[model samples]
Target: MSDAVKRLAIRDRIAVLDVLRGLAILLILLMNIPAMGNLESARIDVTGWTAADQMATWLQRVIFAGTQRGMLELLFGAGMLIMASRAMQPDGPVAVADAYYRRNLWLVVFGLAHALLFMWWGEILFPYGLAALLIFQFRTLAPRTLMGIGLVVLLASGHWFGTQQYNARQQLLHDAPAALAIKAEGNPLSDDQSATVKRWEDLQASTKGTGKETQEERTGRTTTLAAFFKWNAKFWMGFTSDLLVLIIFEASATMLIGAALFKWGIIQGKRSARFYLALMLCAYAVAIPMRVIDTQQYMTLALDPRPGWITYQISRLAMTLGHLALVNLAISTGVGRWLLKPFEAAGRLPLSVYFGQSIICLWILFPPYGFGLWGKFGMAGMTAIAVGVIAFQVIVANLWLRWFENGPFEWLWKSLAYAKLQPFRKTPSAIHITAPI
Candidate 1:
């Protein structure tokens, strides 16, 4: 390896990266709490909402919705590049490549377990692992080149996907009444028409419920382990089938952008304060307005929601970048150190924190066997739960790291990646001391 690679390998961990991860994890829980707890009414639909619930919904839409996940994806991409840089040491490329794939392979395994056992439909790990496998090939590209390619792919995919969804929604609405009329007349519909009608029905059923009972009640009634598996397996199969393209596109594109940012040193707090300030200003100036308009159009106008979807790509990307810039600025300006420790600890042990969250939610929120809290919480309640979960994780992470070198899951993952057992305990001798002389 060249001196550049060696220098990269020996560079200290960037605190801001961990802070970003910690913030992302916290925000992600907030964004996902409603879905995890099966709070269907807490979604964008504002039907029969209380003032507090409406406020919560608006806050989620304006700030926490897609942005957290976007930041997480960006960080994942940056982490990939950082790992790859270390792996490119002299005589280590092949070994590093092996470990990279191994790590991601295990991530896929963990993600599968998370989805099936935890009953969480919003599992991102599997999609992230799959995207990583494909993204690894571009690790050596220049920052500008990677960013260019990522932007093009992101825009293209967003436009194509949004147009398809728009057309589908329009077609579904157009066909529903006609199909119902045919059914009322006792006439056999054509197979194609029937298929469209079925799609419409499925959408309605999934989104609006069947009216027999809430989906949470039906799904949460599973008492046995076997029943839970059976239900989740079916759910996973359907969820992945419908959203696979969107998942892959979103993960891959944002990751590529992250990789580019890592190379540029922007994500490492190496950029000037003025540069970050400008980035923050410009990105938010564009993104916040677009987001507001998009939310308003969707909530009030009952529009097709496709234009918003397409613009979402632009707004989310800009806002995510802006968030990165703001974080960098904070760190560089010295405001980050005191406030960042808990987040850094949580971020360092992200895998543990992530799985820990699933466990907690399962025990507290999953039905019959647990608290049966699914669908019981409104937006405000869910937000409170999310805050509580984050606070608990932060405290636990700080305490755990005081004695351990890695989170339990992180140790296991690293051991598997390196094909050897890793030292989990923090050794006193490993701590540096000044010479008595």
Candidate 2:
């Protein structure tokens, strides 16, 4: 590699951005535990719950639900910009495209392994990697253009997906009565009718699961790795279509906005306190209430499983941007650096911390071989565990950063991405660290 490429490789890591990413990871843990611990209860299944469970579920849906994922999407876009902004042509040992594409391809590999091996289908690495490949070129776009195009894409996606879902439910609503009537009259249902009825039933299963289905899932997941792998693979195939939608449009839209923000220098804590304060207030004012209404709609959705007119994407963008503004405001105002300091270290190792979460929950905490805690807790209990896991990661991340330049998984990823041996210690070195994941 040339001296320029080498120097670019070791540019000093940004602190405030790392802090923001670290905080996003911690909040993601809070939002993710319900799904990580019990797949059945990841939706609206509140079976065998307590008052605490109800309250926890309410709190998560109202405030912390989609925002965490949104924040990560924003950060991912910014990080991709920093990486992809370098030399575009194959100039040296590490061309920008080679390193960047290689890095994200490894992320795809990691994501697939995380889901199939760790049994966490909700993992974002795979999709984030996919979105990264598509959005990296937007790094050079003007901030306003990126934001404008992103907003259009986001709203359009919400409208299209929501309408499609609504139409499917409408079809089922039309077909069900006719199908039942025909069956009752001793005639078989048509193919479209049968498909509509099945879709209707799947919608029911999505919101609330029967105890029998939950038990069967838990048994399949916890019995053995080979069995769980086969089951997980099959299950993933069932939802690959929705996953593709999320990858191609929804995540890409949010990421575009993130790149715009980064282009404007807002994500680097360069914005004024007043500016961020106003942003946070306005975003939250719009989003929190929207989420409350969305929650109520979901509650009723169990009975009416059709997708209705909703602000799913709008609320998510508002809330996620609200969090971005809030964090930058706190940093710019210097009001909470003490609390945010440890997160700096935590953020630097986002790759390790993120994948580590799956290892902790899926590999050790929830599996039958470890604690066998899968499907044992409701939302409240699972959330409590998530909190503990977050604490553990934060403490360990700080300590790990003291002696090492990167977490273990980070070391591996960097090595593979750059196609070179990356320095891994905190000692004085000729190289700098890669940006946060």
Candidate 3:
């Protein structure tokens, strides 16, 4: 191929990635809307849901919940590898490695700001930043090696979590009598004992609740910015304390798989249509049944302590891969070409769309402000809102790309990563012409 042809091919490949990223971001918003409005609502018992709400929740669980974020993580890893390849071209290995770390350091800064200011405790960027730092060291390893390491770590972490939960439940059971005696006799229990009893009480209570908002939870969904910040601070502190390990592990594992897939050319849409179709078939064959069983167990068991939770991570991975295969198949076969364009545009500017979603959600949901609709929207309402936001973003992204080379935040992030002012605007004659296949 000629140089121009190669460049066009690269661009087209990137556009495909952008479409995937855009789709993933939209799905993430769909998954997060309920939590953004009322954290408890995301976990609302099935009995509490209206038919529409139940349908929406079921759709989200089956289609997007454990899958979308994984796609994003995979893209991040692929992007990292792409950057590493380019950086190595001219600057040598050490300089490229330095650049990689600096980029991730900046991402960490962005993640912190997003989590603290936006009050989104479920932020992935911070965890992605941390995982990037760790995974960078393994860049020289073979793709299969990286994938193997990731799988082992993911499985181990899942098992560890299950073991911890089971042990905690057992401990609580053992300490319940002592706690009762202390309460009845008006005797003070040790702090550790008190904590155990409290955990057990909370776990038991969680099984019976209709997902009603607690006083503290309701207080957090405030109208005033100051109140929101206060609640966010508390939420951040709690989340950072114990859950950080799981977050890091999950992010790292997904990224590792992404790195492997990218190396294998699957992520870049270089795979044959037949390969993708077969992958989709096999992956769903395993994932759908596994997910159904898992969902059924959760509904019936009500979060009962069980070792089976460890296998859930595997099921989620299967579903994630299945989704990836289906997307690649659609794109490769040109079946989704027309529908993919807007998503590709949005994908090209993912950072902007990501923060924009948060800003939009905050305005619409927070009280006495934009809509004062927080805690009022059921699952169906929230899903509708998410779709509306995505549609708006797609339109905005297409319009913005007409004049700008990058999204607002994308330009800023790239500038920060390079420690220089990068070009932001597209030249007058710089329109992207798609290469003919």
lDDT of 2 by residue, 223-318 (tens): 987766676676666666555764568788888988899989887777788888998999999888878876777655444533334467888889
Candidate 1: which stretches are off by over 4 Å? Answer: 1-11, 39-48, 86-92, 182-188, 201-207, 211-217, 220-223, 301-303, 429-437
RMSD of candidate 3 to the truth, in angstroms, is 4.0
Candidate 3, residues 1-437, lDDT tens digits: the string is 11211112224446667788988987799887777765552336423467787778777766677688888888878877776764434434566677778788999988998889876767778888998898876666688997998899887897788678777766677788788778679888888868876765666555544223344556667557777777777777787787887978988988888888998988877889899888888888887776666555654545455444666677778788888887777876555776566687788778899888888887555454667777777788888988988899999998998888878888898788777776678875556654321
Clashes of each: 0, 1, 0
- Root-mean-square deviation of Cα positions for candidate 2 versus the true structure, in angstroms: 3.3
lDDT of each: 0.74, 0.75, 0.74
- On a 0 to 100 scale, what is the lDDT of residue 394 in model 1? 93
| Clash total of candidate 2 | 1
lDDT of 3 at 88: 31
User: In candidate 2, which residue pairs clash?
Assistant: 10-432
lDDT of 1 at 381: 79
